[model samples]
Target: MEAVMSLLVGCFFAAGVYLMLSKAIIRILIGIVLFGNAVNLLIFTAGRITREAPPVIAPDMDRLTGIAANPLPQALILTAIVISFSFFAFLLVLALRTYQELGSDNTVQMRVAEPEGDTLPPLGY
Candidate 1:
């Protein structure tokens, strides 16, 4: 199971990178989302999946007796998910605004600072 999950995570990362390298803004946003998901899955797999009991100790016992699921990774992943979601939303809005103003999502065509056919600025100090 772990092996299969690891393979899936690798594939997600590869696909995310491929999408991110594209010139389209939408693809970049999607790639960012996919990469975030891949990271979450990677963290989950690293936490070690087990069929053991939850991480709780009996009232009488001072420490957990048998196996207990690690809680740190789950917490971290949850936090990452929330943060990623908020960031993705912000990026999406920004992309939409850019598209509205520029009428294009291509990185090359959105070069307002350096319009096509313009002479290069001087580089002297």
Candidate 2:
């Protein structure tokens, strides 16, 4: 199972990077989402995959006696999910606004700040 998850994580990272390299804003957004998921999975896998009991101890026991699933990765992944969602939302809104203002989502065409035919600045001050 760990091997499978590792493979999947690798695939996700690859796809995310591939998509991020595209010129389209939407593709980049998707890539970011994928990348976030990949990171979460990586954290989860690093925590060790096991079928042990939950990380809880009985009141009568002095401490946990057997192997228990690690809770840190789960907590981290949950927090990361929320953060990534908000980040993705913000980026989506920003992309929409840029599209509205420029009427294009392609980075190559969205060049209002630096129009073509402008004289190049002096090579040296």
Candidate 3:
């Protein structure tokens, strides 16, 4: 189980990194979201997977056969999810603005928009 969890985390991280390094804004946005998810998952996995019982305890129950899950990871994940959502929303707006300004979603075209040749004003002037 631990090995599988490690593999899953590794896969998510690799995919997120790949997407993040892409030139396309949409891919980048997705990458950021994936990265956040990966981090949350990794943290959760680190804490260890526990029982199926509800996190809250009933006073009557004397003992639980299985170990209880660490609540910190759950809380961290919830916080991360909310933060990631806000980040995704912001990225979407940023991407939309970028597309609007560039007139196309191609990053290469944007790169070429800058003057490359003898198009600059004199340095002193």
Candidate 4:
């Protein structure tokens, strides 16, 4: 099970990186999401895979009876998820604004908006 999970994590990371290097804005967004999932998987694996063990302490179960997966990674993942979600939302809004202003999603063609003329009218003349 560990081996399988490790392989899956590796694949997801690879896919995410592959998408991240693309020139398309949407692909980059997808890559970011994929990378987040890969990170979550890596943390989950670090917590150690286990069968049927609850992380919470219970009076009925002895410590020796079953080894539980660490809860710390889950909590970490949850916090990371929330932060990443906000980042993703912000990125989407930013991207939309970029598209609206630039009129293109191609990274190569996109340019920062610049005022056409260099000279400006005197402020208080």
Candidate 5:
């Protein structure tokens, strides 16, 4: 199971990176989302998935008698989900605005900051 999950994690990361390298804004946004999910899965796998009891100690026992699921990874993944969602939303809005203003989502064409021209800027003052 762990091996399968590990392979999935790698695939997600690779696909995310490939999408991110594209010139389209939408693809980049999707890549970001995929990358975030991959990270979350990685954290979950690292925490170790086992059918164990909750991390609670009985009154008769000084310590947990059996394996207990680690709570830290769950907490971290929860927080990451919230943060990543907000980030993705912001990026999506920003991309939409860029497309509206520039009339293009292609990175090659959206050169508002530096218009395409054959002439070069004057050198050193």
Candidate 6:
């Protein structure tokens, strides 16, 4: 199972990078999402997948007796999910605004600071 999951994570990362390298803004956005999911899955796999009991102890016991599921990774993944979602949302909005204003979604064509056919500015020391 771990091996399968590892392979899946690798594939996600590969696909994400491939998409991110595209000139299209939409593909980059999707790549970012896939990258975020890959990270989350990586965290989960590192936490050790099992059917063990939850991380908790009886009132009488001071420490956990048996192998219990780790909660740290779960918590971290949850936080990451929320953060990634908000970041994606912000990027989507920004991309939409850029597309609306520039009428293009290609990074190469969305040149605002240094447009084509313009003379290069002089370099200052």
The best candidate in terms of TM-score = 1
**Residue-wise lDDT of candidate 5 within 32-82, one digit each (tens)?**
999999999999999998888889889988998777989999999999999
| Error at 15, model 6, angstroms | 0.4
**Per-residue CA lDDT of candidate 2, range 1-125, in tens?**
99999999999999999999999999999999999999999999999988989989899998999989999999999999999999999999999999999999999998877888798779997
Q: What is the TM-score of each candidate against the true structure?
A: 0.91, 0.91, 0.78, 0.78, 0.88, 0.90
Q: What shift in Å separates residue 55 of candidate 1 from its native position after superposition?
A: 0.6
The ten-residue window of minimal lDDT in model 1 covers 48-57
lDDT of 3 at 2: 72
Model 2, CA-based lDDT: 0.97
What does each candidate score in C-alpha RMSD? 2.1, 2.1, 3.3, 5.2, 2.3, 2.5
Better of 5 and 6 by lDDT: 6
lDDT tens digits, residue span 1-125, model 6? 99999999999999999999999999999999999999999999998889989988899999999989889999999999999999999999999999999999999998898899999888886
Candidate closer to the true structure by TM-score (higher is better), 1 or 3: 1
lDDT agreement with native, every candidate? 0.96, 0.97, 0.82, 0.84, 0.94, 0.96
Clashing residue pairs, backbone N/CA/C < 3 A, model 1: none
Per-residue C-alpha lDDT of model 4 across residues 1-125, encoded as one tens digit per residue: 87888998999999999998999899999999989998988998888877756666668866546566677988999998998899999999999999998898888767454344556668995
What alpha-carbon RMSD in Å does predicted model 3 have with respect to the real structure? 3.3
Model 3 weakest lDDT span, ten residues long: 109-118
* Candidate 2 vs. true structure, TM-score: 0.91
Worst 10 residues of 6 by lDDT: 116-125
Per-residue error for 85 in candidate 3, Å, reads 1.0
lDDT of 2 at 95: 99
Model 4 CA RMSD to the hidden true structure, in angstroms: 5.2
- Model 5 clash pairs? none
Q: Taking the candidates one at a time, how many backbone clashes does each contain? A: 0, 0, 0, 0, 0, 0
Task: Give the runs in model 6 whose Cα sits over 4 Å from its true position.
Answer: 117-125
Clashing pairs in 2: none
